[model samples]
Target: MASLKERITRLQSSALFRGMTRESLEPLAKILNEESHKAGTVLMDMNAPGDKVYIIEKGRVRVSRVTSYGEETTLQELTAGDIVGELAPLDGHMRSAKVTVTEDAVMFAVSGEEFEQLLKSNHDVSYNLLRELGDRLRRANDNIISRLEEQRVNIEGRMLRLHKLTEASKSINSTLDLDKLLTRILEAATSSLDADRGTVYLVDDIKKELWSKVLQGSNMAEIRLPIGKGIAGVVAETGETINIPDVYQDKRFNRDFDKKTGYRTRSMLCMPMKNKDGKIIGVFQLLNRTDGAFTKDDEEFIDALSAHASVAVENARVAQEMVQNERLSAIGRMASTIIHDIKNPMSTLRVYAQVMKRKSGNEEAGKLADEMIHQVDRFVNMTQEILDFTKGVSSLNIVDLEFGEIMNSVLDFIQQDLEKHNVKLLRETQFKGMVKMDQDKMVRVFYNIASNARDAMPNGGSLTVRTNEAKGYVNIEFVDSGTGMPDEVKKRIFEPFMTYGKKHGTGLGMAIVKKVVDDHKGRIEIDSEMGKGTTIRILLPAA
Candidate 1:
């Protein structure tokens, strides 16, 4: 919008035209190209051929170069009266750096031929342009040096972290203690990546959850979450690594733990650990990296570490299995010898109890003998259970029996135990029907349940025993008012060698109980809650 006279005055103000009078500037200003640019516009790209020189009459533009890592380092900023792309045209080479508009600006441009002729004719204009180019060259050199030094430091830091990971991998494979192994894996991760806190969750397929146990001070905490429920859980389920620069920005992130613990979480990285077969076995979660958010480099480092950790975990498991197998071998031999030695005495007692029952018929003595015979048989069966368990063998003699007959014997036998533990037994045995089952094995099922309930209620509680018939099935349910199981134990309650809160517990009671029910074509269902109680219901086919 400027008039011809105004444009002449503006040209007169430029240092490049400092020595020119209005007569000399007027003809030049009329031919010079005028251009305008918005902020962030790239006026000159690095190494691109330049055909004209630009003089900024307004606004500012940054000159920068991209580093090897794709980071841009600013070399200089030019505002009004500064010239750019002049050196490249004068020297007959490509532009050395990129020029970007930092703000909206109008510029005056001169073709390379006109610029050269003007510089040649005017000494002051040439001298001023030389001074500005010298200053830019010096600053550009300094910026390049600084950027190179930064890249060197970054490379060295990465090398150090990789070295730490390599050494940790060596120690990890040799560690056989699973708790110690878990500790080592997490320690290496947090320290190597500069993370604030972390956890390693092993997947429990039977429970369909990602679970971990941590010892905080003197207490051990067991945490469990469903697969695909949270970030880490989803990583485990999908076998992918999830890196969130800002946890608060991610809707999938749960901030409740941070709120409760008063920990400010800024970032998170979760990786899935897989076994040799490519099956995901565990998940690793790292929270709040000390260096700010986790980066792509961090993810790469963690991915390598997770692979090493997976092998270490699997190796520890294999080593444990070897030890356990050896232990069971020893237990099996001792049990076999003991069972052989006790068989003769057990048979003799059985014969005597039967004879006493037959001889004392029609008297009170006969009833006591009958009870004694049943007690002897039960003791024999109990001993056989241990031997059979060690040998991994089981046999059942199925028969038709009534619920009333079973409950009557169970109540009579468990009454002494219930009184000893101060656990009162409430019965609802109104329903009666024939259930197809093994008499001895069925008795073992009820006995194991009573024993487990007694152990659960150390201080004194009530155990309710009820029986019913529905849909051609007889149900025997035992509900105990005792301390319930945690999720970890409740999930695998039927698995062998799983026990809780017992000093001399064999951990085989529930395993045997479930086996007995399974063998008789019946099923056992259990429901337990912490600080409340447990309910165990057994269903058997009715005759």
Candidate 2:
């Protein structure tokens, strides 16, 4: 489009070719071919051999190269009066980067060999080219320094997160209480992630549910959901991380809890917490990030925190279990000593009471003697219950006796205790069949159940002791009209130390009852409801 003089004028204005004489630029312009390219055209490709050098006469071109991650990164941009492919020709190697036309452009292309010769023959042009290359090198150096500074800041931030995590893990790991440990983990995780609130759900494998004790102000509320129900549940089931910036937009978000608690959840990040074995044990759900949506860095930090939390959780659970086992062992040792020392004296007291009843024919004194013997037997039964539970003592003095005789004895034992508590005992003995049982232990079983019923009926209620034989078993039911158990307590009723609303004894009454029944190859079933009453049915093999 321009004349020869105009083309030479343009060449002289270029920074790399500036200060060149007309004679020096004449031959360079004469050999030049003007090429027009559309946007997005590749003028030079990375790693391609140097064939030509182009002087941009119009529009823009971008110099970019692929990074190690296979991402294309723009190095620099060249506009009109700038040149591309000059470095390849100067260095006598392949192009270092891909150059693409960002805007429709016209360029003056000269063969690489000719461009190299022009640089050598023109002294002033060569000096200007060196100056241009030196400016580019300085820019590259600045870019490197800027990147290094950014990386340094990132590394420092990561180090700080790691330090916080270490302290948090230490605090959580030292506690044997699973509840307190989970609470600390949630607190530390929320602080580390800069979230307003958080919850840690533990997987209940048997129930196929995810449950957590979420702290609300000074109280902790138990929350449970099926493995695939909610955000945390999904993370628990899938073992994947979920980051939702706008929770309201997600259909899975339930606003009911937020509405009830008067809390608004804007963003959420949930991730699976896995044990050391890489098995997902739970999920950490963080809500309403204080800053904004959770970033990649937050995700990475939480991923690490989950690892520490999982290990701590596992340790706390194991420690709690060991503590229970050790406590039971200690009780077993104490019971063994008591049985050795007390059994002989208790037998002598029972024999003396029998003699008193035979010698003193007074009706009231005889009744008093009978009570003394019963009281001695009760003390021995109490000690034996502990010994049986802790020592796994299953030896039973099996005898075939009328089931009614056992029920009548249990009724007489509990009637006195029940009368003192204003609880009425109604007896309905229908099963006359013989049962293979240990009479003393079976009496303890019936007495324990009746005692628990009496305690439940603190405000004067009726207990019906009924028996019936069916399906090769004799069913003895202690139906009480008293304050019953909640599902939570009922589920763990047989576990040692589990108790509800009782203040008098070690919470091992039901546990011993279960152990005694289990030894007789019998099973016990319980039906209870809050505010209603409880029915404990013990079924023994009918002889």
Candidate 2 Cα misplacement greater than 4 A, ranges: 1-83, 93-110, 117-149, 216-219, 349-382, 393-409, 426-443, 457-493, 514-543
Write the residue-wise lDDT of candidate 1 on 1-543 in tens digits: 667787788777776676677987777788788899999999999989988898888999998889899989788888888888888878899988899999999888889888888888777678878877787779779877887999899999889988998988987876899878888898889988899999998988888998887886676567889999989888988898899999899999999988998989999999988877899999989999998999888888888888899988988889988876665566667667767887798778878878887886667878887788787778777877777876679898887777787788788879778998899999888777787888888888898898888888999999999899878878888999899987667867987677788888656778888888888788889999988999999988888
Q: Which candidate is the best by lDDT?
A: 2
Cα miss at 457, model 2 (Å)?
Answer: 4.7
Per-residue error (Å), model 1, residue 6: 5.8
Evaluate candidate 1 by giving its C-alpha RMSD to the native, one decimal: 5.2
Residue 434, model 2: Cα distance from true site in angstroms: 8.5
Clashes of each: 0, 0
Task: State candidate 1's TM-score.
Answer: 0.74
TM-score, every prediction: 0.74, 0.73
lDDT of 2 by residue, 1-543 (tens): 778999999888788787778877787788999999999898889889998988898899999999999999878889988878887777788889999999999989989889888877778877887898898889888987887998899999989998998989888887879889888999888998889988888999999998887555676666789999988888888898999999999998999998997989999999999988899998989999988899888888888888888988898888878988888888888888998998899999999999999999999999999989988987887797787778776677899998776678768878988999999989898987799998888887888888889889889999998989879999899999999986667767998888889887777788988888888999999999988999999999999
